[model samples]
Target: MTDIASFRLLQPLSRRALLGSAAAAGALIVLHPFAARAQANQAHLRIMETTDIHVNVMPYDYYADKPNDTMGLARTASIIGAIRAEAGNSMLIDNGDLLQGNPMGDYMAYEKGMKEGDLHPVMKAMNLLGYDAGTLGNHEFNYGLDFMFNVMQGANYPVVCANLTRGQLASDPKNDDLFFKPFIIIEKTIRDGTGAESPVKVGFIGFVPPPIMVWDAKNLEGKAMTRDIVEAARAWIPAMKEAGADIVIALSHSGIDAAAHTDRMENASLHLAGVDGIDAIFTGHQHLVFPGPKTWDGMAGVDPVRGTLMGKPAVMGGFWGSHMGLIDLLLEKDGKSWKIADFTTEARPIYHRNEDRKIVADVASDTRVEDSVKAEHEATLAYVRTPVGKTSAPLYSYFALVADDPSVQIVSNAQTWYIREMLRETEYRDYPILSAAAPFKAGGRGGADYYTDVAAGAIAIKNVADLYLYPNTVQAVLVTGAEVKDWLEMSAGMFNQVEPGASDAALLNADFPSYNYDVIDGVTYRIDLSQPAMFDKEGQRVSDGEGRIIDLMFDGKPIDPEQRFVVATNNYRAGGGGKFPGIAGDKVIFAAPDTNRDVIVRYIIDQGTINPSADGNWSFAPLKDTSVVFSSGPKGRQYVGDIKGVAIEPAGDGADGFALYRVKL
Candidate 1:
């Protein structure tokens, strides 16, 4: 979280006031020791959290196939050690997303294979660090239930997730308590002001996003069921409190939102805070840090930033080993009870800031962790390099978002092709198909050199992962014509609303994450930038809530609300990432048991040559006497010549150092 003034002390009260009111000054100084003692003896309960780890045990990014300094649990090892040394009492916990992300994870899953007693490398590293507990992230199910269970067996600590349960039974007879436990209680000694150790019981309850079973339906089918996060918390918290636990902490794998109540879209950290007896909440999945102390709406005395629930303390650590969350709570002895007197919360980054605004990694790799995964790393290098298939023509997504480009068309065609065969015996086999794919290699965050450059030749497995980095399996959600329109309106949230005839309007939304925008190519439509977005970044509807999609037509006709169509997308969106109407996971007609990256690879293999050209199936809304400007790097110069019906000219360099282009449409 950003630094706030509340944590820092102000210059000793105005000298004039001190001098004019000597009596009040003396009284303030007399009371200062109590406040100072409270701050000094504050039972600092340091909570170190890692989220969305995606199995990067080493300091590397396997998708980019490079040693990246920006992400890795190994790099953050020093910070974790230092933070633990500074705190009075510390607990290390991982908020899920640990199972799959890199080639290393894939290598372990497919090539090495998890044996019954084999220890997973990632789990071994986490064990060495002494993790107290962990929850399941959506990616944990990528390798299916059996694999997940086998991997968890390697963890030295309890794998806790209250929301997930086995099918048809309270326990799995084969390996009871192997995959997950509802909660865990740890007894620790806390030091009083006189340095006397007092016994304290800390309770941790873990919860994963309930939507995971829906998102990873192919893997979770008939194996497990997931309950909503808040509902699960409500059921579990009371029992946890009754179990004689003084402090209760939530390892929430769900996200925190500005919303006050629990909804299908909002994970409801606010609602979780309102629940009685919840002491502190450790949140994840959203990958954001709470900016400051925020009281739960309609709840008394709960401050999320101060790491307090119902006057207790809470924190949401930033993701990818970037930051470790710290929450310190001070308790006062009152007769036979220890009640919290004060608290503080901080999200500390692992990297240090340089004068040039660059983050410097300070930790050296833990040799034990590195040695454990050395064989796996070498195997992944070879596995990713293995040629999967040949692409007869260049497969580029330069125009994927603006036009019906072959890159997206290839993926769309592949999804439609895969679903048709998979659902031959299903009831929805006759449904019309539409595919939603986004420009994963889009310009932003990914520097100028980050675009896809797969030449017309043998494509390797690494290239496939590059094209689709996220571990999102293919899901086809059935929707009516009107819902389809709303879905498009939601996708339009990617662009900034440009005023009519405004030449310098920004093309993309700075705050709206680019990865979440899915460009549906099967239907013809136009984005009207003149209208505001239908929804904001938090999924809240735009103030006006009027449709932003203009002239939306399906099959050369105006959309028919009664007509139905199946739009193929990744599991994330179908599970609720977009919050688009009528497109939840329940609407899924078919979920391919393979990742979208795998499908793209198979598609490229089946089709020898991809021309990488747009079919002109979609275009912008009419721009009469209007000119718009956008920025792209020198690499994008090659494809700007392909935009139809637009007069394009080189404008100037953008503030970000990319070449700016002015287009008259």
Candidate 2:
């Protein structure tokens, strides 16, 4: 952690009083001249940010299915309080996705609808903390737009989005505002070292990913429209500068996109740096913390890529309020205006990463905040505990991707079935149906108990949440057979290219996130681990790759490029999530209001009894008599009975008692 005193403020205490206090304490006092000089000449602006909160307000991760001490905005509140104590001026902002993720959000949306004047539990908590501004995340529309606006009524702060637009209001005879105020200018007075007061104006502009319109089209259709984020920034930043903002900070809900590994713009911070008049940026949506200052390629004067935008400090606090982003700007008075002199950005985590390799909360949550939402939290627990469906067989994803597994197949089947019905009235009703479902129960970030373990019995609301944690609605996209092959090629990027002779550890990209690994189950194909990934993270082809997808067979026949197929997938993926080729939001033929979890529950109930068996539609290219070693959570231990052509050996504990299985395929 950086020393707090480096960015010192002018002492409000007088020299004589300081001397007297020092004499009273019998201690020698020394003051840095630089602090005094900076205090007299510079104004400091502090920005606090929260992103990807996913409504874990109480420090528990329902998705991890564990009591995580590291996360929760309540934990973040402690850091906010501390930062405020040290700074003369500060602003608190959230970057989006505050609406869903945990049972708290689900309970609120389903069990307790928002009353006319009633406040949302999370918004209520944020209001007490005095948030300056926030933007909408994609998940905000999960419960529907009306619910979002209803909950927003309780917020004390402005909910800003510069790209979203509303239609004309008939009663008002004028169009409602699209997005939010392009920017907000805030004026604050600060005391100097000599007991003099200085006035400063700070401007904030908010941006959300335009893709939300497609991701949540079911809820957003004909209500509002979205524009590209970068394009929107280009149009709005100039207007903010003209509006007399001494410092302009972008509250960007979009993550960075960089094609080159060398360029820092791969993260949103760096990308936003290219925008003019954006003096500082507080970025989120990627759920990553800026390690420290970094500079991007072809950028000069402390590029925002390195935590400084146009030489102004910027920071992205990690998600779930795990860390509070802090940027301290040293400004010099140029005539009547305060110009930035020097600045630095830092993210402080509420829970310190301890020597024991565990994150220990540095401070306790504000009792008042917890007390405010205690009732809602309890109500949510009760709601999630209720049984929603019954399953005759266990719904586990133990062999999901490794073999033809039924857990994922059931999900895929349900999604396709749902889409087919939904499109019955649409123009694309005759399209051949295909469903794309990934192994949500895969043992990765989800710990030992994270896998679905409802064993041939009752499936409760908790089980449903476990099966489908994200609040993604169902969507069907139309794509040709060739595009399907490309989509699978992109999905293959999830795996590390295994060299013929490399060890298992060498066959995985340690940095590659597990969520991006979407296993396409409806198609019969083989993943050639020996081949390099066709596309990179940005969806750019690694080579002039014509066909990374081999055998290209659908139902035991070569796929025709012109043959159109409607692939069923969750809203996230269908709306440019994995950056798969030819699967943009525009290609969507049908959108279902039901989430994948709900569909799964409905399917299980309708079936009465399920075999939970995979029909072996997809498999790996001949393992060539070679053995592959993999690890899975203990919850997967019970479902290892069906893996074929593999020698399964128990290889002791890996991550959180995730039993390692060495299989010779």
lDDT per prediction?
Answer: 0.67, 0.67
Give the TM-scores of the predictions, in the order they appear: 0.68, 0.68
Residue-level lDDT tens digits of model 2 in 1-665: 22323211212223111112233243223332323455665655567788888777887655334666678787676445446545555677887888876678877887788877888889867877878878877678888988888888887888777767775322321133674665688776755544467887778877766656555667877887665555666777777777778878788876554432231121344556677777777777666675344323454434544476445566778777777787777666788777777766777776666687766555456555677788887787776666555665677776554666666766777777677666765678887788787777676666666565567766665676556767677888889988888888887776666656444433345455555666565567777776788888878888565544677777678988889998889888887887777678688765554567767655655666555556667666655556566767765666666554334555567766777775554
**Which 10-residue span in candidate 2 carries the lowest summed lDDT?**
10-19
Clashing pairs in 1: 307-313, 307-314, 308-312, 308-313, 308-314, 309-312
lDDT by residue (tens digit), candidate 1, 1-665:
21111111111222111212233234221212222354433454556788877777887765557776556776555345445545566678888888786667878987789988998878877776778878878778888888888998888877788767676433322232224678887777776655666777788888777666555677877778766567767777777777767788888877655445544333656567667778777777765665344223344444544555545466767666766676666666665445566667777655556898875654445455677678877888887787656765566655444455556666677777776655655677787778887777766777665566677777777787557767677888888988888787777887777777776666767666656777676677777777888876666676475676777777788878889988888888887775765567578765554568766655665666444455566666766677777666566566667565445567787766566777665
lDDT score, residue 70, model 2? 73
TM-score of 2: 0.68
For the record, the alpha-carbon RMSD of candidate 2 to the native fold, in angstroms, is 9.1
- Enumerate clash totals for all models, in the order shown: 6, 6
